[model samples]
Target: MLATPSDFDVLIVGAGISGIGMAAHLEMMCPRRSYAIVERRDQIGGTWDLFRYPGIRSDSDMHTLGFVFEPWRHEKSIADGPSILEYLNRIADERGIRPHIRFGYKVVSADFRPDEARWHVTVELADGERKLLTANFIYLGAGYYDYDDPYDAGFDFSEFEGDVIHPQFWPKDYDYTGKKVVVVGSGATAVTIVPSMADKAAHVTMLQRTPTWMFSRPAKDAIANFLRKVLPEKVAYAITRFKNITMQDFSFKAARNKPEKVKQALHKRIEKALGKDYDKEAFTPPYNPWEQRLCLVPDNDLFEAMKSGRASVVTGNIAKFEKDGVRLTSGELLPADIIVTATGLKLAIAGKIKISVAGEPVDFSQRYYYKGCMFSNLPNLAVVFGYLNASWTLRADINSEFVCRVLNHMEATGTNLATPVLTAEAEAKIEDDDLFDFSSGYIQRGKHIMPKSAKDYPWRLNQEYVFDRKVLRQGDVDDGLLSFTRAGANAMMAEEQLEAAE
Candidate 1:
């Protein structure tokens, strides 16, 4: 039997950007709705607080990464982890969202009761106590990657006499000064760490099996800064956000439609940054631009570090780990005093929380994603999985607003349950598509666990931010796909009829 009297109207998992955004939206749109945010960590910022490595910053510009309701007033568009954390904290305090967040509480599992039209959520408290809380709806914003485990590249670190560190778990006050540091992998983490560590390390070498496309832009946005000086803060922010979103969308579409042209443009920028005589193989990727996310180098910092003889890039397969350093397949020995495995992340679905409906476990791989937020046949639950090609908060903002619309619709219609029901006949007619079309290692590894997708909107997680913004914001909530029903409506009606006969 389920607990009586629901604890909250909505239970938001993870106090990350997505979770906070949802809460903020509820305050503005659904003022009377009671909601709570549960976060495993003891802090407010999710990724910003977790990652403490040097030069840890946002790959995307802050205008887009920031919440739509808040303005990013920092001079630098590419913000550091601390500054981003500060922004989130400010939003929480100003909006009174911090009071609603219960830190150090991890959601263990959630089971939806069809009869009650609510979810019985099980959470593990900080002191290892399991608590039960029931809510009318569940919103998961726990992020995509596993917080406890990172993607293991399966490297033999026995022979290495130096300290081995993964960026996910950076040691506090780690002294790499005057030490030869080697950072493995070629993604954003490696690019950011190499240049930042080069300032103190004797030398920093980035080792990668394959090269990744790199793009450089100034940390500060000149136009955005200029607009801020002349216009009001909110107006300026709105204009800047719109501009960045348009440019991002255009670039992604261009890369997809005209690969060769985009590739040439990217190569030209790299050639200009590193000089024409630089090693093309070290900077060139086999795939076209945006095939994987392009590493953003602020103010050509990585290139400057290379030019200063403090940092370098080496592309080769690792043969083994030597006593002093790593051995390459090409019979090259890169001596190092410290090794930083700047590897990728281990992706997880729904924060790895066990979900069930009517006593049956939910297999997300078999269920279809309904409009990128809710799942098919899953009632009163929504998960925020951000965009791959653009800023994460862009999707988060839309999804939060969409959820608000859903809640308001339910109240107006006097319905207790909202489920996106996909009939067997309709499911048979739809074709399956890759949930995430990207070739990133994490995406490929986590594909089997992800929800199924189709070729069209309302069935798949749409990549186009502009398109999603319009559809999610202006779209109808009572679309025939979503079936709404009141809990115990028939029994109540029958009782009323019997009373009338007497």
Candidate 2:
């Protein structure tokens, strides 16, 4: 039996950093309006709380990753997972957003009904009971990466007599101490896990299918720390945030404008850190800088691990899983007591919730992203997704502010529906490399599921703070693609337009 529908002015999914940010903005914009933030987990911190692998941490600097309105009070720029999680929890508690979050409620599907001009949401409870809800607007703050098991279940793990573990679905009771372990994958997660686990494990081997460019920076920002000691936490946080943002803008510009120089500098850094004896071809990516995410090494822990003879790196394809270990394509048999598959995550956009309009499924693959927020033909729904190059929160903060502006505009104008009106022709011809060129598993799933543009101003992902501020923060809201309609008028909009034309 379906329970009575819970109504709200705004309903947000995923209670993560993005969702909470949106909720805070909504509260500030319309205090009298009803809003709810739904989360599947018992706790609030989305990725930070879910991932419990050995020495888990953020790959990006914390100065840029933390919320803009609320500064992160931590001394370190690159933070471990627990510290990051604690900071998020503290923000929720301090901001009074915790009370608004409905824990253990997973939204299964959401359908937009034109008749009511509202979204009908179906959510499943922790107790295996289903509930129905309706709202004027739906905000998808659910992140891109899947939080479930990290490994591909189809992999023939049974053939390996050794214990296998995926970082996403870590076992609490299992101990890696004094055991020879092989960690697979070459991205940030694998790079981090090997160095941290090497000290505890007897021997840690990092098996990379393709080498990624790794760079080292100190975990603690000396300037930021000095400022924290002299000034307030909030003030220091702001200073660090500005510094990080400016640095990112400069780096992105340099990479784009002076590609050769950026590549040369990157090559020099890798050579200096990895030593001249290291295979340069295996370590350097074939694409330009920021084509894929770069690996972050805090204070060169990965190199230190290698120097101490506790860790080693190998580049090869896995042929098959043997009873005792992995067999590489080079015909080398690496003995491993434990295998860690840090393979990438599954991409789940809008938390993979099914959406339908007038009983017809809304094919996300066919739709286009409007300014990387709302989708074409989908009214009153916005998603939060950041750039692959720059800090995620910086982009998300802009998105949050934009959402508030949109909501305020709707209220003041008496508009109930706003949707991007991209034509089939525009969507079909628009081509950008970021949309389809990615080889990552997550990108593969969402290939062509977003808007792609080279120019950063109107619809492109410039990843520059300056460009984003001018276009997203201060740009005109009444762009040509967005259409607004009042309540009870959506149904008659097409008919009225035809009559007026006649």
Candidate 3:
């Protein structure tokens, strides 16, 4: 236990988008609070920095993905990886957040000391040395996937002579020029990679077990660009963000309420993009529009590549990998010089950091998610899990603001502890709900590790951003559910207070 002169008010994990957003919020709303950020990677921009595959870009528009406090001045709303990194860097430098970030430091585990009302965080440095730090609160801004490993689809590449690669660990400057490339998935990564690689590769094939629904939109937002020319940057950004958020919510609701109609509209757009002669089976997914995230194609680039015979789509399971190429279950042989396994990600909760309360390990699966941020019975800790239906930053912004509110309330009340306590009776009364309603492979596989959700507010991670914004932003801090107490308070006293409130 290394002792320091003072503990940080908040210790943020992962200097990514969520961490940066939370830090910026603290600066504005709780300026008196001290904080620090620990990043596992050597650089900023968590997702954007990690991925270096061709045509790597945001699935959602930048208006909503960009932080609420900062304006995305780039021309392209569907920004590339470098552009997004630049935006994040500008925010970090401009807000003086870079100085507070400690790169190459990975959080191994965190233990909450109830008596001290602080978390003892153990971190492993890049050189494999361990150090300890204490903080009043811990904010996990680390993004949801396993950074060390990608999803393994169990493809037998033993006999395949081609260079196999996963997008998570793309080799630097590895040329695929004039080589036949087969991207083994039809998710956003495959869609982005096929067209990008087709320019240099001899031919590119997007191989998928099942088709994925895709929608085509321009890379640049005409309305957003026009507004920027006439109005103030912040005002224009706000309007654009509002418009996009509304459209996203409406689209999701429409897909859920009227799946057939939404499906037809999506197919109609794809039909217009790809000619009538195109293979419809390869483009049509069995699921509804929003069941899984709809891949976005910028300016019909994918369609153009397919039309030009540079790229193609193959919808089938791989029977085995042959020396020359992949052999499909349909007995079709596709020749390839390189294979990219864009088979999606493996989700890890709380950045896979071992969390415990008073020496007893906390099982998040047994606990309830409180207001889409903190887990029930967890003291002074909040994890940022972004919304599935909208831009990741939408939830990030709201969660950051909400956490700040809790911190400020605790300060005003002279309390150092805030915990969402769910009693046995209350827990039994709440019916369990799925953490996420999406049928995406990652979501389905990661359900067991996720925090439990319930049927009502303040007890579940709500997916509706509009509803969450109002409740998390404007709702009272002392809502009878969250117990605020001073440091060194006995457990019995907190329980008695909760009982009295109930």
Candidate 4:
């Protein structure tokens, strides 16, 4: 059943931002060690390449999102998708990581062999051929969302004989110039699509089950623009990053502290923009602000679209699809030539790879996350996941740095194995109240895999840089779950006691 395998020191899954970042770090730190990046797609730039919705851009500014070593020279804070993809490609080229990338390679499964002390990975190539790769360690930089479209809930699309499209699979040759379009969902993608598509489409209608809190702000930072004119690109990037992060964090707190007052102010602004046409109650969301994400509109583009009569928001659940339109639950049918399903993404944890050790399944659902990097009982594996509040790359960069430190530590200690160990008592000390309570698919799926820590010590993500610096960056590399074994111990342990070996 086994075949000859290629070998490497490290094997990274996914060639997206995280994987590229990891590759950059690994190449810099461990040049002597061999590594390869396996990407399923023919090209890189994971989410950016996957999402083709009109006007799609970063929800957060590109400064902090960009790599620290490789400064992003984009003039706009919220850069477009093509620009971001280009930046990733540039980074990969600049760092010489492209040659090591195995494009059109998808890893099907991985198992940690206790006897061999290596991961036996089964990867399916673009051709119908399969191959194996043995590596000392595995890093899952695989993105969190599912690849297939999410709006496959068996909605009655046959009744509506008009064109229907999902953003994930947006057709390049689609002609929506003169057609009346109805876009469904209220996420960032929907917010972005409405404004851009409205500029061309005959009329655009935004259909939503619930309203998202929309905040309109300048797409380009005035100060950053001025800085770019005078200061160097790196200097401008740094200052703008600092300014954007401060403002975003402050806005997050502002919404949390004075929710009702802020909501009232936002409501007033919407009313002021729409005049008498603004239905006061129709645009309101039930939950506290940011409990679900707040949608950002660049330079009031969506608002301007609505004001210009190019776009209008319709708040109601879809009753069903009619012959030439969508019938809402509120006894109203909206005529449309095209319908765009902007439904939320389906989240797949660690890209849904089944990881097992010693022929026993590693119950990832039962495992707890440690520093959001490695899981309990999963050895020689590190995941680069970021914070929910800050830029994903910020946390990813830190995780990269931490991983380098860990590798360095392990190398210095002359050890080849390490994993987080959560004892029953340690796990029992965690409180459920301290965790993120959102019901989004991403959050809910993560809750099962993430660590539950008391607000103090090893279990908390305080959102403070200083605390993480001390806990994660400068923290002890050996806090117990990780055990080191030489060549002989692995074989002897497998022969004797496999369950307790780790």
Badly placed stretches (over 4 Å) of model 3 are 1-6, 489-491, 495-502
The 10 consecutive residues of candidate 2 with the worst lDDT sum are 493-502
Model 1: runs farther than 4 Å from truth? 1-3, 490-502
Pull out the clashing pairs in model 1: none
Better of 1 and 3 by TM-score: 3
* Candidate 4 C-alpha lDDT tens digits along 1-502: 1255438878999998899998999888877778999998999998888878788798877877888667777677778999999999998998899999999888888998855667988899888699988987888888767786363645789889889998888888678998899998887888999989998999999998888887666777788888888998888777877787677677677878989987987787777667766777666887777666677777788888998999989999899998788999899999999999887766666777777886777776566566767775567788866656667787677777777777777688776666565556656666644456554544665565554434554544445443565666777777655455544546454233224433
Query: Model 2: per-residue lDDT, tens digit, 429-449?
Result: 566445534455556655645
Ordering by lDDT: 3, 1, 2, 4
For 295-340, candidate 3 gives per-residue lDDT tens digits of: 9999999999999999999888889999989999899999999999
lDDT of 2 at 112: 83
RMSD of 1: 4.2
Candidate 1, backbone clash total: 0
Those runs of model 2 whose alpha carbons end farther than 4 Å from true positions after fitting are 1-6, 149-154, 423-441, 448-462, 489-491, 494-502
**Which ten-residue region of model 3 has the weakest summed lDDT?**
493-502
* Better structure of 2 and 4 per TM-score: 2
For each candidate, give its TM-score against the true structure: 0.97, 0.92, 0.97, 0.91
Residue runs of model 4 more than 4 Å from their true location after superposition: 1-6, 149-151, 268-277, 433-435, 441-457, 460-466, 480-502
Instruction: Show pairs that collide, candidate 4.
Output: 421-481
CA displacement after TM-score superposition, residue 163 of candidate 3 (Å): 0.3
